[model samples]
Target chain A: MRKRLRNDILLIGGVLLIAAAFALIFFLTRKEGAYAAVMKNGTEIARYALSAEGEYPITDGETVTNLLVIRGGKAEIAEATCPDQICVNHRAVSKAGETIVCLPQEVVIKIVAETKNAPDMVV
Target chain B: MRNKKTKKLAFLGLCTAVTLILAYVEALLPPLWAAVPGIKMGLPNIMLLFLLYRFSVKEAAAVSLVRLFAVALLFGNIMTLAYSFAGAVLSLAVMNLLKRIDRFSMVAVSIMGGIFHNLGQVLVAILVLETAEIGYYMIVLTVTGTIAGILIGLAGYLVLKYLKQKEI
Candidate 1:
């Protein structure tokens, strides 16, 4: 019992430290400006931008779902065929703290900022 | 003596197969929450932690090597394999070294492995990209590593318990 208590304390301390670290990252890290989309099946499926709007299609071979468009820098699963429909519930992602995951479709859309002096940018 | 040696070799082979399967399984899982391009859940580490305790260090190393190569071939992502392999090797070394300390539990060791694993991978990315700023993801990586390590450690603990009772 005493050993378990010690372990619990350690875990809690670890969690606190991680929280602090995330807080630091939240403040210290700057959002990269350029935006890019992760397309599926040659369609403009998911968009990552500060502000924009357009039609997108979600295709799974034979079937296709028309996803509603969100104009701006936010990613969301506007439509899907999966039974869960959890993807639609995902709010539009903006501010680098966002992610829209479609598990059944194996699609992950995210936004990332490129670092300054990024070799690609440097050259 | 020769027969015993053969049995040991077979056992090592089996462990290698199990590790390979686990790693490949993780690759198949949907990257739903992968907001960043390279982030992953790495569920296979669960099997790794289990092997570290159930089998010998040499056996675990064998498993890691075979798993790395097999996954690389199967996924056809040579760059990712290269980075992941570097991380896994470094993490395994750290775990083995920490295993020598009596006070460290398997779970703690696994957490250390997770932290080092991400650190090593991030370092590889930085080097490959020729950009030091990629290191800014260190905090995020550490957070994810801690969570993943703990989850895998829990799985290891459960499996170990079941094995102890079943005598498997």
Candidate 2:
């Protein structure tokens, strides 16, 4: 019984350690993105450099509308016509690979670095 | 022997019903993390762990699949179904493997299952969204998954202990 308990403790400790390592690696290697890509229906409709601050309106004719704001190296959805308002509520994202998705309108705003060596796979 | 088979089938159905009810209750609750889309308490996983421990893997798999479909039909859309189906299958497979290893306790198994569940959903999200950036969400999801897994594992441990005491 003592052995079993010890094993359980070891297992839990190992998991925690692994989680901490991964978190540390993620934060340490995090890159600030240079561009924000506005995608609608799985296609990029517009791209803006995060170096400049601006507010852009994203619309798919009369069907969907979202207001995107980029400032201080961060990008966010300031307003959205989607019912859930999830994208608007999401925190501004400046790091590479961050994304704000408005599911109702199929709008996806993603941060991307200008580097040509961006990993194609993240497994 | 026939009677015993019938009883086992009935018990499996009961487990499935219980799982579905738990999933429904979880869905009714407000989002635990507003920023993430699929975060939840994973209440139904407690039932899955219990079923896996007490019964055969096939029986547990049956209950898990049925509960997924039932909940999706009642309260979720296609996207929810897809994400959940992937997570459930991956978690169950990992738990079953861990159980077979016989080295880890139920709590450890459940925690691993929870982490894999999040990993599976993130994989599906990446595919559906056509972007690798979704992988970044895995960090937050893994942390939340671990917490939820611990809760579910503790609940399962308590219930299993009670059942053993009752000789059920």
Candidate that scores best on DockQ = 2
**DockQ (C-alpha) of model 2?**
0.41
Indicate the docking level reached by candidate 1: incorrect
**Cα lDDT of model 2 by residue, A7-116, tens digit:** 87787678777778877887887788888888776677788888779888887785448998989989989988866677888888888777998766778899888756
C-alpha DockQ of every model: 0.08, 0.41
lDDT per residue, candidate 2, B47-129, as tens digits? Answer: 88988988757888999998888887886778779988999999999999989988888887888889899889889877777
TM-score of candidate 2 to 2 decimals: 0.85
Interface RMSD, every prediction, one decimal place: 8.2, 2.6
Superposed by TM-score, candidate 1 places the C-alpha of residue B129 at a distance from the truth, in angstroms, of 0.7
- Which candidate tops TM-score? 2
| Candidate models: Cα lDDT each | 0.63, 0.81
**Poorest stretch of ten by lDDT in candidate 1 chain A:** A114-123
TM-score, first chain, each model: 0.64, 0.74
Superposed model 1: Cα runs more than 4 Å off:
A1-19, A22-123, B164-168
